[model samples]
Target: MQLEPDDSQSDRPVPSLAAPEFAAGDRVRMNALGRSRHPRYGERQAVVVRKVAANGWRVLFEGRTSLLTIHRDYLEKVEPV
Candidate 1:
């Protein structure tokens, strides 16, 4: 099922026009430097399962079946550590 944008945000933000960054199975980390922490920040370290759109991506945490749709701006590629 697709998610609906929050009604509280009356001024809808424009979607990014850039190309999708991460591919399926790519690992990513949330950029929490300037942005506020997400309610599900615990899943910041996740693997990209698919691209939702040019500006959105679907990611899944290790051992979790449910995937979350996250904005591209909030995500950064994770290098092997």
Candidate 2:
């Protein structure tokens, strides 16, 4: 007797582009520098994990996970850090 094979896991399609919108608890990169309290004011590397306002976001800096509120003008999408 002969047996038949199955192929049921190769019919789904993958996404091409992602939607534009930053949410809380999301990891993102700093694009530009707008304003800050630090002496070294500028687009320093950081992560987005909180939403402060309609066009604002809270990010976590290197070596730490503390959320820091910042405006959208001070952020830019970047590769995972």
Candidate 3:
């Protein structure tokens, strides 16, 4: 499913226009500087398992077993040619 802009945001950071719509099975990469303290922060890539919200996604990071809900700001769509 695609993300719709969240007009309910109060103090939260708004989602960027550059952030692509995510779907299950799509490959994505986590920003190296995103979520510095997250356990999966070291992982460079992941698969989008679900879009949890307009700004969050459930991802399965490469080399990891557990699924992590990472914000969309930290992910970029990996369009394969």
TM-score of each: 0.63, 0.49, 0.65
The best-first sequence of candidates by lDDT reads 3, 1, 2
- Residue-level lDDT tens digits of model 1 in 1-81: 999877887544334466338889899877753135565564457899988755788988667789988888777788887
> Which stretches in model 3 have alpha-carbon errors above 4 Å?
1-14, 32-43
Off by over 4 Å in 2: 1-20, 33-43
Segments of candidate 1 deviating more than 4 angstroms: 1-20, 33-39
lDDT of all the models against the reference?
Answer: 0.72, 0.57, 0.76
Model 1 misses residue 22 by how many Å? 0.7
> Judged by TM-score relative to the true structure, which candidate is superior, 1 or 3?
3
lDDT of 1 at 58: 90
Query: What are the C-alpha RMSDs, in order, of all predicted structures?
Result: 7.5, 15.3, 7.9
- Residues 1-81 of candidate 3 have per-residue lDDT tens digits of 999877787545456777767889999886643645454465568899988866789998888899988877777777797
Cα deviation of 34 in candidate 3 (Å)? 2.0
Q: Write down the TM-score for model 3.
A: 0.65
Ranking by TM-score: 3, 1, 2
TM-score of 1: 0.63
Q: Report clash pairs, candidate 2.
A: 25-49, 31-76
State the displacement of the C-alpha of residue 73, model 3, in Å, after optimal TM-score superposition.
Answer: 1.1
Best by TM-score, which number? 3
